[model samples]
Target: MSRRIIACEVFKPYLDKLLEESGVEAVDYLEIRQHDHPELLARSIQSIIDETKDVDEILLFYGLCGNAILPLVSKGIPIKVLRVHDCAAALMGSNAAYRKRFEGNPHKRYHCLSYGERDDEYFARTSPEYRKISEEYGEDNADYVFSMLYDKFSTPVTYIKLGLDGEESQIRRKEEGYYSVIEGDLGLLRRMLKGDDDHVCVTLHPHEKFVGIYDYEEILTTVNRNHDREKTREE
Candidate 1:
């Protein structure tokens, strides 16, 4: 069956690596930009679905980002989504690992990496939408909006490494309040891309609509099993 992936642009670097490593060919992608404006991504996803009528399954390199993927799934081709709340989980390598690190307030912390944001070029600051918000709501209100949008990476933040290389790693290391880099595994991504489906993927058949992430038990179960296997291998 032909497979396609509709991935967030933020996942580019990791996706590139996984594709090279997995050696799975015949995958296509619709790159959606990060940020909370779900409508744009929703539209992009729909456009791809319309264009790729021959695809047997669609894998989304997305989380249940602010209900962005909620409206995209339907009764047509099967859609596969990672069992994650956001891309941070993907970088952490699993939802369980992501939860363990940012246990207190999952939404308030940002996982800084080159693929997401390490050089501080946050999306909201430079996006055209930010300028539009400033014009419509005034600079004061715009800052407020930006703050709320990226409140996770707020002041006095600690950085954890998600395995992205280069200066971002160094900056994260020397900076105060920064935690040691926690290495992340790419096994889940590689499995999903290859249609392995051992765990960590929630497949929605055609004619079914995604209600919420409560439907992701199978995925988590699989990831947990994978984790166990990895531990055994290490031992």
Candidate 2:
């Protein structure tokens, strides 16, 4: 069956490499800026899905993503979503793997290639909330607010290397403060692309909606329309 991929732009570089190697095209990348508002992110994805035609299936390169994927509903075409909390977990290959590393270390920030490339200003500039704060409260207050919201935790950053050549040097050079590097496995993504529905993906069939369980294991599931209707009738 013909397939298309809807992925976050943050994964573009890595997905580009994978698509090139696999010779699979037909992918759409959405802006990372939408991540500032999960609701908007979900709407943007639904818009893309609404516009998609001729594709038998859509492969989403995303995680629960602050529940952004939770509202997505499949119509005629089925959607396969990566089963993880976010891109960081996807890079680590699984939710369990990510939890093993950082479950207890909640203060540590996880950095990847895309995250490493952007500076603090880039994030602040991209965030609409930050812009509003800056406009209303002034730049200094905005900085303080964001720093309190995002930079309160003090710990060495953990950089995940996705096995790309020259990535280590680039990340090491850009990352400030103490940091550690760990090899990231793309095996889960490879499996997803290969259509191996073993455990790394949750497939939403036509009329089914995605649901986030808010846990490390069983990260997401699909709610069938029939089941929802039954529940509504019972209620």
Q: Which candidate ranks first by TM-score, i.e. highest?
A: 2
lDDT by residue for model 1 (1-235), tens:
6777878776666777777776656444544443457877777776776676776888888777776676664447877888777776777677777777677754445544553353344444776767888899998888897777665465444344546565364554545654344577776677778785746667766555555534333332112324446788999
Q: TM-scores across all candidates?
A: 0.71, 0.88
lDDT of each: 0.63, 0.82
Worst 10 residues of 2 by lDDT: 117-126
Error of 1 at 71 (Å): 2.1
Kindly report which residue stretches of model 1 are placed more than 4 angstroms away from their true locations once superposed.
24-35, 74-76, 114-119, 123-139, 150-160, 167-175, 178-180, 213-235
Candidate 1: lDDT over CA atoms?
0.63
Error of 2 at 81 (Å): 0.5
32-113: candidate 2 lDDT, tens digit per residue? 7687799999999999888888988999998899999888888778889999989888888888889999778888787777
